[model samples]
Target: MIRFDQVSVCYDGTDRPVLRDVDLTVEEGELCLVVGRTGAGKSTLLGTINGLVPHFTGGTLAGRVTVDGRDTALHPPRELADVVGVVGQDPLAGFVTDTVEEELAYAMEQLAIPPDVMRKRVEETLDLLGLADLRHRALSELSGGQQQRVAIGSVLTAHPRVLVLDEPTSALDPTAAEEVLAAVTRLVHDLGVTVVLAEHRLERVVQYADRVVHLTGDGTVTDALPADAFRTASVAPPVVDLGRLAGWDPLPLSVRDARRAAVPLRKRLEGRPAPPARAGGAAAGPLLSARGVVVRYGDVVAVREVSLDLRAGEVTALMGRNGSGKSSLLWALHGAGPRQAGTVRFTDDGAAPGAAPAERAPAPLRGRPGRLLRGHRAEADVGRRRIGLVPQTPTDLLYLETVGAELAQARRESDGRPGLDPRGLLDRFAPGIPDGVHPRDLSEGQKLSLVLAIQLTSAPSVVLLDEPTRGLDYQAKQQLIRIIDDLAAEGRSVVISTHDVEFVAAGADRVVVMAEGDVVADGPTAGVIVASPSFAPQTAKILAPLPYLTVAQVADALAAAGSAR
Candidate 1:
């Protein structure tokens, strides 16, 4: 249904083309998954589908892109709106109406569909995407996952032949992500609609793709089946790696297949003890404590009387379903969100040991509530800055024109602590980022690295991150894991609120599950993840009773067994 012939896209003042000599064809009803590293041409390639690349983005296109036999070169996005529906990484940006019902109907109104037809399609879309309960809810009140479903429904209501989604499940929990993907699968199988999806979390979507397109960072694309493509692809899901490690004849893409092939490997690890749990905050007293925390906005209570503790030199992961108050609790603990009936105490050595919670004054607000929630901050005393937070939206902390400018501004704002340099930190966190590149122009992973470097400039006692793995590729996520480990090694506390189960399995020292504004489960990572089927990682699910969270852990156990033998 979509074709790209000898396509090359070059932006203004850039020496290299983002996409070079690309030739691809996506057949009707087929789901094509595009995989690539950050800053690759995946987004650029998707934009070319509906003529948003050269037409709306002011880039130069050398070759032809056609959708449904209509040339994108001859048709702008508006002209092809009926044929292609594009949903970006951030659903909030694409929303045009305030309420879920209105947003879903906006596309039909644009297409001038008959009133009766529009009403019928809206109801069908609401039921299809499982958004019927949220139809009357305001768009702003919906959670990230709910907003994503609404965004997709808004386009599906127009009955487009092609759907292009970028990181559609990044913000969703495991269960919610499955629901959305299942809906898309039904459209492809039942309705014969075409889908082109790009996602960083391959473990969630790789098994469902009909074909995989691997985009090398050097402006080239290679299309192949899932197994062949992932064999040599730099980034792959955990199950693929496990298959490779076990020397399975054919690499398994899904958990069920992997488990079947793991019988022998499981026997090899039978008597070996599972990997030891990583030490957590209990070694030292709580560095930060939240007691009876309650956060409310108007009549809605995002967090209700939740008590938690963060110990020095520990990594804690806050996990739950969408709208479970994970983000609210993080913001409250950081002293940036409204705490209607709670006390947040920074128990560092600077505070009096015997001082009561009420005696300690709250930290002054550094920026506006919105800005602070996005990780932005004004200058403050280095010693007094006990907590640093990177919110769900990393861009809120970035406003400078270029990477160099943002780094220079951060250096200037620093308190001249010894061995603290933003430029050096950026190099360590995300290498190869050009100084002249615009902050907005950088990829999602790169933007996150920039903000993380900015937050680390303060060298606070505690670090809190919300959805840090939203758009990060496997390699980028590994680097982030190393950063988190290093922070704990240096006696700093770290807490991350995320729905990426694999990430939680790989890095988190402890897991805290929240639901309905209350802490439902809190314990070591292995116990917490293994108890719930929904939150368990692929490896744990595959080897149920084996207590292995990752392939690496299994490998370690095997190595220990070999050594003992």
Candidate 2:
């Protein structure tokens, strides 16, 4: 259904081609998954399927791409729209209609399908993707997960021969991601629809993929079975990694397979205790505290009256379903988002000496206690800007044209302020980004890194990242883990609002699950996540009933046991 022949893509400004003479093919009704590091040409390759690379994106394309027997080079996106359906990372950015039903029918309308057929397909898609209840809902009112489904439905309504998705579930919560992937699998298995998906979170969608397309960071491509591909592939899901760590003959692609092979490993680890919690040092007073925090939008309350403490050396993960107030709570704590009623102040957590709570003073940046801002306005009389926030949309914090300009502005902003070097932080966060590249041009993961570097330049006492690992591959995520660890090591409080359970399992010191604007569960990482099937990571699920949260933990325990014996 889809084929690439000697395809190489190179943008005007960059030196090397994003894709280097790639040759690939996707059979009809096959679910082909594309995996690669950030900015390794995953998006560029996806674009070629529908003629977006050189045609619309203004890059140079050498060789040919054919979708459904039509040459993408000869046919532009609009011409090939009927044959190919594409959904991008940000669904809201692609919506052209106000309501879900209208969005679904919009594509069919453009293709000039009969009114009756469009109506029928819209209803079927609504039921298929489980968006019937949201049919009348406004596109802007939908949650991240809902928006993504609507976006997919909008394309699916057209009944294209091939569907191309770029990081479809990158921004969704775990359950929501499951829903989206389930819908995609239904399209593949039930309807025999061909799908080409590029995703960073391999754990979520790898199980559903019929084939894996790995873009080896050097611009080449490898096509093989999921098992064969991940056997030696640079990137593998937690289950596969666990299988590797346990020396299983064949790496397990899913938790069930891994669990079936983990009987012996489980027995070995049966009596071993999980690592101790890091809550002891966290008891030394909260570097930041919030009480009765409330955030409301019109009549909807995003964050309920929640009181929480953030310790200086703790990495806290705020997790819940989509729109469960994780982001709102993070913003409320950072003194940025709308707070209907609450008190967010920096306490004397030993960082500051003998200072009473300055309720009406300023933001915590200056070590001065300032209550959370009630509305949109930032705190007044702020000292050093102690709390830094990287919002869910990293682009919101970036307005500069070029990356160099953004880094330079961050440097100027923190010139006299005692903070980390912006340039240095950028390299550490995401290396090899050219100085001249436009911030808007960077991939989602790269943009996140730029914003992270910009935010950390303030050297805030507390750092909050909402969905930082959205588009980051395992390699980039590993770098983020190190970054978070380093931040906590420096006695900086870190709060990551994310739905990437594997990321939380590998990096977080504590897990705080929120639902319906309330803190449902809060405790140490393993204790909190291992108890809930919805939030548990793959390794935790594979080694069931046991509290092992990651492969590294299991490896450590086994190594310790071996040495002791």
Candidate 3:
């Protein structure tokens, strides 16, 4: 259904081709998954399918690309709208209407479909994506997961033969991601729709893909079955790593298969205790405290009476389903959003000895805080800023055109600090970003790194990151784990609001689960994540009594056991 014959793409002002000699084919009714590191041309490859690469993105295409035997060069995106439907990374960028029903129907209207058929298709698409209940809700009011489903429904309504999705489940919670992936699977199996999807979170979608398209970082592609492809692929899920560590004959792509093959490995780890929590030691004092915090939007309350403490030296993970008030609480603590009713206080440990307490003073029941929370200078005197926040949208903090300009600005804002160069920090967190590339041109992971480097220039005592691992590959995620660990080591508090369960297991010391605008469960990572099946990692699910959270931990335990014997 889709074919790329000697395809190569190169954007203006760049010498190297983003994609080079990529000859590939996708059979009818097949689901192909594209995996690669950040800025590895996965997006470029997906765009070529629907003719958005050279047409919309202003790139040069070397070879012919066709969908359903229709050459993309001859037909622009609008002309091929009937044959190809593309959904981008950010659904809000593509949304034109306000409400869910209108957004879904707008595509059909553009396609000029018959009114009767468009209406029937809209109903079926809503039912298929389980968005019927939210049909009347405004698109802006929906949760991230709901917005994702609506975006997919909008494209599905057009009844395109080929569906191209870029990071479809990156913003969704686990349950919602499963629902969306299941809908995509149904489209491939039940309706014979060809799907080409690119996602950084391989664990969530690898099981659903019929074939894997591995995009090596150096401008090449390898196509193979899921098991065969993962053997040498630079990026892979935890289950794949577990299978490799155990020396299984064929690497397991899904958790179920890995669990079945893990019988012997589980026996070896039978009596071993899980690795110690990264932040097992006790912290000195509360760096920041929130008392009876409440946040509301119009008539709806997002965060309700939530009281929590961030310790001086610990990594805390804020986890819950979609729309569980994680984002609201983060913003309130940072003093960027409406607090409604709350007292956010910074302790002396986080402040200077003579410095007055930085407080988010409560106003009326519907009023916001008097002043925004800035990092305590005392903390800055000790070689660290008081607080830094990276919002859910990283781009919101960026404005400069080139990466060099952004880094230079960050350095300048640091006021000629002794050892705070933005370029040096960028290398530590996310490397390989060119000086000339625009901030918007960087991949999601790369952009997060740039913003994180900018925020770290202040040397903040507390760091709050919302979904930092959204677009990071496994290697990039490992780098992030180290970065968070270093922050905790510096006696700084770190809090991350994310739905990536494996990331929580790997890095977080404490897990705080919120539901309905309240803190429901807060405890050590092992205790909290293992108790909930929905949030537990694959290793924890397979090795229940052993308390293991990752394959790396299991491998270490076995190696120690062998040496002792």
Candidate 4:
């Protein structure tokens, strides 16, 4: 029910067009998925559906776009609001109401929906999105994933014909992502709602998509069915990659199909072991020790009496369901969040750049109950900046106008010391970012990379990244994996809080799972994730009893086995 004819979009201050000479059509009741690299024009294309591109985000639109028989060029976002509902990459930025329940009803109220209908829709949305428990929680107090659900619910309550979701499942855990996608699929199947979704985590959504829209970095778009699209897709999910690895005919599209084809491959790899692992933590002592830590928000005990230790040269993946206190524990260990009762002891030789060890006293956390990581870290003692954190919303840490300015500011904060060069680090993380472009204008993945550069600029002994893979595509995630490996090799401790199971599978040295403000599981990556059905990656599921977490690992095992089949 959406059509684009000779569409091309160019924004101000950018030389090349973001979308170039494109023609596409999304049929009624079809679940269309947009896939592309980090800087591709996926978001720009989605904005055009509701007339936000040139109409609100000033630039030029040299084509005709229509949704549900109405021309987008002739209408502004408000005029098309009834036909289209959008949830953007940053959910908190789009929130206008104070609480979850209120936000869900705001869109319907604007549409002049009857009070009775609005009330019913809001309740249905709460149950659909699992937000009933959080109905009264302040939007600001909710976790990043919670805010995303609220954003989607806010739009769903309006009953728009077309739903445009940008990275809808990025913040959610594996189970939560599945629930949301399942709900979206039900809408398309039962109510004939057309959905146009763009997501970075392909594994989470690819299985649900009926069609694929690949946004070539050069601006053109490729539309095809799921099988045709993935066959030639530049970045594909693990199941697709596994099908390709096996050279299976009519490449499998889902884990179920892949598992059926995996029988022969399993026999080929029966006796082969998983790839040799690295020296995790190198038997090092704790870099940071937190004991009896507790965090409280009003009457809510966000974190209970929990204790954990971070060893040098280790990459620990913090995982759990949404609001399971993963973020709270990270903050508590960093001494930034509240610690109702705890003793934090630290002994890092390289606490901070150019700071003497004697001056770097291990300062304790706050004694009062309450809570808060993920940004360039600066501590009171030593002025050494021993710890760095990159929080869920990486953009909140950025205030500068351009990417270059952010990099320059990071250097200034760290005194331009060696290994503290933000520019060099950013080049490694995300290359070719323009120096003059505003940081806010950068794509979601690019913004995450920029913040990563800023935080790593301090050369902290311990780096804490919460949901670092939110906006990153598979290629960018691979690059990040390399970075994580390098950080551990340098003897720096790393703790990452994320729900990207595939990411943890491929990169993490260890996995720590939290639930209900307590540590539920902690052990090696494969052992912890493979044992838990809720957290297993597609590869782990497809090749169950094999202990293979990634497709690449499986490929390596086959190659090493010298299997001719």
Worst lDDT window (10 residues) for model 3?
Answer: 360-369
Candidate 2 residue-pair clash tally: 3
1 versus 3: better TM-score goes to: 1
What TM-score fits each model? 0.94, 0.92, 0.93, 0.94
Per-residue alpha-carbon lDDT of model 3 for 187-207, expressed as tens digits? 899989999999988888998
Model 3, stretches more than 4 Å misplaced?
A: 277-281, 350-384, 417-420
Whole-model lDDT, model 4: 0.83
In order, what lDDT does every prediction score? 0.83, 0.81, 0.82, 0.83
Q: Mind giving the per-residue lDDT tens digits that candidate 2 earns over 430-461? A: 67899999988888888888888887887777
RMSD of candidate 1 to the true fold? 2.7
| lDDT per residue (tens digit) for residues 77-183 in model 1 | 99999999999887888998899999999999988999999899889988877788878889887777788889988988887899999899999899989988998
Backbone clashes, candidate 4: 5
Model 1 segments beyond 4 Å from truth? 277-282, 352-379, 382-384, 418-421, 563-565
Instruction: Tell me how far the alpha carbon of residue 138 in candidate 4 is from the true structure, in angstroms, after superposition.
Output: 0.9
lDDT string, candidate 4, 134-166, tens digits: 999999888888889999999999988999999
- On the 0 to 100 scale, the lDDT of residue 98 in model 2 is 95
